[model samples]
Target chain A: MSHIVVGIAEFKFAEPPHKLVTYGLGSCVAITCYAKEAIIGSMAHVLLPHAYSSSHDNEAPGKFADSAVAAMVQQMEIRDIGPSRLIAKIAGGADMFAGQFMGSDRCIGARNILAARKALDKFGIRLVAQDVGGTAGRTVEFATESGLLVVRTLRGEVKQL
Target chain B: MGSTPFLSREQVAAVEEIATIAAGQAGNALSRLLKIPIHIGVPEVANVKLSEVPALFGGLDAPAIGVLVPFQGDIEGNALLLFPEAGITELEEMLFGSSGQAEDDLRLSAFAEIGNILTGSLLTVLSSLSERVVVNLPPFLVQDMAGAILDAILGEVGTLSDEVTTLTFNLTGLEDASLVKSVLIPGSAGIELFLEAAGRLKTGR
Candidate 1:
C-alpha cells in the first residue's frame, strides 16, 4: 500500500501492494509498464523524446523516451519479467500552448508522445492504453497488484485505464 | 547541471534590479485594473536547473493556472504568471465579480488579457532600463500541473543548457492576500545582451 512518487525526468519500479505515481504531466509523458503475474511495475517520467549528448552532462536514462523505455526493459528483466510479458500504459503529453511558439518541433508534447510509442514498438512492448494529446495536464497512478492505471486531469476528471 | 556559472554576481544583481523595477510597474498596472492595492515582493533572480524549476511553485503535481507569454526583440524570453489552486476561486471572483465560473471562456479570456497587461508592463520597464525594444507575443493560458506547464515551456532550453536564468516575482494585496508568482526566463543570447547593457549602465561607458 506504500506509494512511490516519481519526479520529472525520473523513474521507479515496484512489486505487488505498492503503487507508483507521477504528477503534473504537461507535454511530458509518463510511461507505466507492468507484468501482472510477475507482480512487477515500472514507471518513468520522460521529459524529452531524444537524448542529447554533452561531455559534462550525466543525465538520468529515464529522462528521454528512447533511453527510458530501454532502461525500463532492463529493470524488468532483472526482476525476471521479460519484455514480451510486459504491458505498457501511458498518460500526459498535452499541448499546453497552441500556435504561440515557433517551429514544428515546438510541439514538444506531440513529439514526446510519438517518440514514446516508437520506442515501445522498437522494444516489442504493447501499449495497451493511453490518454494523451490535449490542452490539459494530468496526474497518473499505477497499481502493481491489480495493474490499474488511474489518470486525473486538472479539471478534476478521473479516468481509469 | 553545468558547473560553470552563466551569470556573475554583478550580472545577477543587475538582473535583480531590472526585475524589481518591472515587478513594481506590473504591480501598479494590476492594482489599477482590479481597483485594489497590490504590493510586489523583492524579486529573486537565480540560475536554476530546468529539472528543479517546478519545485519553486510547490511541486509538479500542484494544480495551477499558468499564463505564458513569449517576448522577442532586443531581448528574448518567456514570462509566466502562475496562480496556485488555493486562491484561484477567490481571484476569479475578484476578477469576474463572481465564483463558480471556472469553465467560463469569457473569464479565461479576461485572465489572459490581464496576463498580457502585466507581462507587457514588465517588458516595458525592462526595455526602458536596458534601452532596447522588447515585444511580447500573445499570452496563452494553461491550467495544469505546475511541472507539466513548465516542461512545455522549458523543453527546448533544457536541451541547450542544463540551467537557465530565472527571475521570480511575488505579489500580495489581493482580497484574500493570496501569494501569486511570476517567472521570467531569458534566452541565453538575451541574457548576454542584457548583461552588457547593465554593465554599460553601471560604468557609464
Candidate 2:
C-alpha cells in the first residue's frame, strides 16, 4: 500500500489499499474522514481555526479548520460517499510550548481542535475518535482499508484509534 | 495574512551580517562549553511564505528538538535553535561528557543553555548594531515534529502576515557531523524597526 503525505495546511484523499498520512502536527489538527461502504477516506491538516478573509480564499482551502472540513466532505461526496456513511477521527493539535500563555486566541492547538469539532458538527459528521490536546507533536496515518487512524508521538509512543 | 515582503535586500544584508557575528559568538561559546572547535556556515537571511518555513530543516514531520527564546521590547520576535533527532544523542553525549545515554531533563537543559547563549549573543549584536535595547525572555525547550514546533510559533505570525522574515545558520565541527540549525523569526513590527535602524545607520541619518 502506498502512503500519501499531507503537509501542513494541506489535505488529500485515498481509496482502499492506500493510506493518508500527515506528519508533525503541533498546534495544528489532522482530521481523517472515512466512509466504510465506499472505502473512501480523506485527511486534512489544518493550520488555524479560520481564514483571514476572502483574499486568502485562493490559497490552500485546507489551511483552516472550517474550510478543510467543508472541502474534505465535498471531495468524499464526489466519490459517492454520503455524509450518513462517514465517520471521523482526529489527531494532533498539541500545545508544544505550554505555559507560554500567548493568549486564548494564541492557544492555537486547542483552538484548532475546537474549530475542527465545530466544523465536523456543522456537517453532522460523527467524531468517532481523537488523540489531541497535549504537549507533544504527533504523526497521524489513516488507512482506508482498515479504517484505522494510527498516531505516533515524537517520543516513539504509538496508538491506534 | 498579507503577502507583502517585509525586508528589503539591504535590510536582509544587514540582518545577515548581524547573524554571522552572532553565530561566531555562539560557536565560540559552544566550543568553550564543550571544549571542542565549532564551525558555522554563512548565515542566510530571507523573507519567505509561512508554509515554506518548515521545509528548511527537512520537513514539517521531521523529528526535532527546538529551543525557543522569545524577545520583546525594542524588538519582538523569536529565536529558535533546531537539532535533528539523530543529532540529539550525540549532542547530549558531547555536552555531558559521558558515553552512556543522559537523562531527558539533562539533555533538555543542555539544549536550552545552548539556545540561550546563541540567542542572547544574537540579540546583543542586534542591540548594539541598532543602538536599541532588546530584551529576551526566558528560553524553553521542546522536542517534537519540526512542523509542529514551527506551527506553535507561527500561530502568532499567522494572525499578522502570510510571510515571515527568517535568518538561518548552519553549524558543524562535531565528530558525528550532526547538523544544527538556528533560525531567527522577527515579527512585522520588529522587522520594521530593524530595517529603519539599519537604513539610518547606512545613510548616517
Put down candidate 2 lDDT per residue, B3-111, tens digits, no spaces: 6666768778887766788788988898888687676666888988866776776777787778878888866766556766654554555566678367878877877
lDDT by residue (B1-205, candidate 1, tens digit) is 3445567788899878766776777778878877877777668889887567767778787876678877889766676666665555645665656554655577567667767876787677667666788888887787677877777556766666667677776667745385455565665545765686677668775
In Å, residue B138's CA in model 1 sits off its true spot by: 2.0
Residue pairs in candidate 2 whose N, alpha carbon or C atoms collide under 3 angstroms: none
Task: Give the distance in Å from residue A66's predicted Cα in candidate 2 to where it truly belongs.
Answer: 1.0
Strongest candidate by DockQ = 1
Residue B175, model 2, lDDT: 63
Clashes of each: 1, 0
Residues A42-92, candidate 1, lDDT per residue (tens digit)?
999988898767542467777788889999999888888888999999898
Residues A1-161, model 2: lDDT tens digits: 89998877788889978899888888889998888888888999888898877877766778889999999888888877777789999888888888564465668888899999999999999999999988888888899998999999878899999
Q: What is the C-alpha lDDT of each candidate?
A: 0.77, 0.78
Report the poorest 10 consecutive residues by lDDT, candidate 1 chain A.
Answer: A97-106
Docking category of candidate 1: medium
